[model samples]
Target: MKQYELNTIPDEGYRQALASLLYQLADDDFILAYRGSEWLGLAPHIEEDVAFSSINQDTMGHASMIYELLASLGEGTEDELAHGRPPEERRNAIILEEVNGPGDYLIEPRYDWAFAVVRHYFYTVAKKVRMDSLKQSSYGPLAEAAVKINTELYYHLLHWQTWFTQLMNAGGEAKQRMEDAVSRVCDDFLGVLTLGPDGESMSRYGLIEEEAILASRWTEALKKPFDSTGVQHPPVIRSLRGDGRKGEHTGDLTDALHTLSEVYRLEASGTW
Candidate 1:
């Protein structure tokens, strides 16, 4: 398979598809990392606060790396790509951009731990599947990024999986909360499973595998945890209309970007 270097990509169609894919990848991590950052000092305990902070930093770094790749492709400077995009231009999954819970991150945040664990766990598994396939991507930079990302993902997946399993087996209100979280996650989870409108071209160009194949892998990967914890597979809602890939987003994303970009917006001309 031919590996496409920065300028070696074959045609206009391939560039557009690859750029779309890059935006999706970058925006997903960028938005979710921002969400994760909200847990700082608010995690269940001090240890988790520290550990979760580290994880959020790593995730945001990954987003930055991808933004640089996009910059190489002439999209914009990495800062602009990361901080300048509007809600409609963001390509993250709808689930990733949703609020961590209700209320503000500051001043009496009634965030739900169950939702955080479930969302991160499920998203991590899906990301692992995607990254695994991306390791073989024909786009050299993306494949390279996938390889580097898998290192942190190893710890990330372990962390979330442990939280997920332990919570589900707690067998009380904890278990019930986790199950409810699973249902809510499943509602928009499909957003992460598909590659959006560019899915066909992405596969054709060998950027990554098709959505069906990736989704199948995600399902299979979750079987072990589900089986061990005796949690049945929650039905994934396929009718979700707020698919973020197509720029369909709720006010959640608007509010998130507002907060996230506040500092960057203050100094748009500054470097990252």
Candidate 2:
């Protein structure tokens, strides 16, 4: 059987654990992509808006694949799984849900491009590390999915890293803005790194690599370019807000969920 091939019912404990990991992956990408979609047509520039949308689409596509995996496991229909779930049930990090800035997407957004770049770039790198680890996961289907997902991430990582490097080296108001944005993103980065309460079990089962190892690798991967450009890397990253893997979230997620699921919610019980 193909590595990415669907399984009817996983009788083994490893398969069940794999399913849970996949759910977390799907949920995280779904929520974050929804936030990214909100930024559409509202970015600082036209070029950036186009580039940003591509990344959002890629993320949503990844989420869709995960949802399909869940569907195969009889979790629920993909549409229902995505749109019908309440905020408290969401598993995305609080940082992914945070508002772009002080205003609605339809209004004068007053969004911060610096924050967007920092958050997306950092998240992309962190995700790359995680995905690389997953490519070697014990679960065959997930390992295959990781290999496939990692293919598109090359562009996503480059796109954000370019923005991060350029802005940090811009040497003016841009640098100050980016610096401030970095501080804000780091405050909640741990939320993205956490693998929930079952992290140890996941690692023990070889479902995914150790979180600390992944986090350190992420730090190292980001540090080289940052050091070359003289951008200061934070001594340590902490989730000052809270952990999202534990189902803790923020108001931003509440608003974003409403927007993304609006049409879906209109006919929650009906097929769209």
Candidate 3:
């Protein structure tokens, strides 16, 4: 697999496809990390809180790398791309932007720990599948970035999977919460699996595998864990809300953008 540097990708279609893929990767992590940041001092335990924050930091760092790659390809500065982009411009999945729970994080945040665990667990597993395929990306820098990002995902996967398994086996309020969380997460989980409308172009250019293949691999990987919990996998994983890849999103993303870009928007031209 010969790798392609930014300057080497001469074809307009290939460049567009690669840039599209990069935006999807960048937005996914950026929004998810912001959501995770809302849980900083709000995790169940102190140790878990610290560990989860680290994962959030790592995820954000991954977003930064992808943004920088985009900058190299003549996209705006990373800060502009990360902070200045409107909700309609964001390529992240709708599931990632959803509020942690009912109330706002700063106010009476009755955040659901079970949903956090299940969402992160399911997302991390899917991420792993995606990253594995990305290692073979036609774009060299992206493939290399995938390799580096993958190094941190092991711990992320272990941490969430542990929580997921424990909560599933606890048998009581915990079991019920986790089960309910799984059902809720599944409702929007398929959005994370989709590669947007340009996904076929990405696949044709070897940016990543097709959406169906990635979804199948993710499902197969989770079968054992799901079986342990005694819940059969859903027959169809549909994007109930809307497709984020196509720039369609819910109000949740608008709220998240305001929260995340607050500081950046204030000093866009000033040095940090």
- Clashes (backbone N, CA, C under 3 Å), per candidate, total 0, 0, 0
Model-by-model lDDT, in order? 0.90, 0.81, 0.89
Candidate 3 lDDT, tens digit per residue, 1-272?
56688779959999998889899999999999988988999999899889999999999999999999999999999999999999999999888998898666556657889988888988999999999999999898999999999999999999998898888988999999988888888888888998887899999988899999999999998888888888777434668998899899988899888877888988899532
Quick one: ranking by TM-score, best first?
A: 1, 3, 2
Candidate 3, lDDT over the whole model: 0.89
Best by lDDT: 1
For candidate 3, the TM-score is: 0.96
Clashing pairs in 3: none
TM-score of each: 0.96, 0.90, 0.96
User: Candidate 2 has which clashing residue pairs, if any?
Assistant: none
lDDT of 2: 0.81
Q: Give model 2's TM-score versus the native structure.
A: 0.90
What local lDDT does model 3 show for residue 27?
A: 97
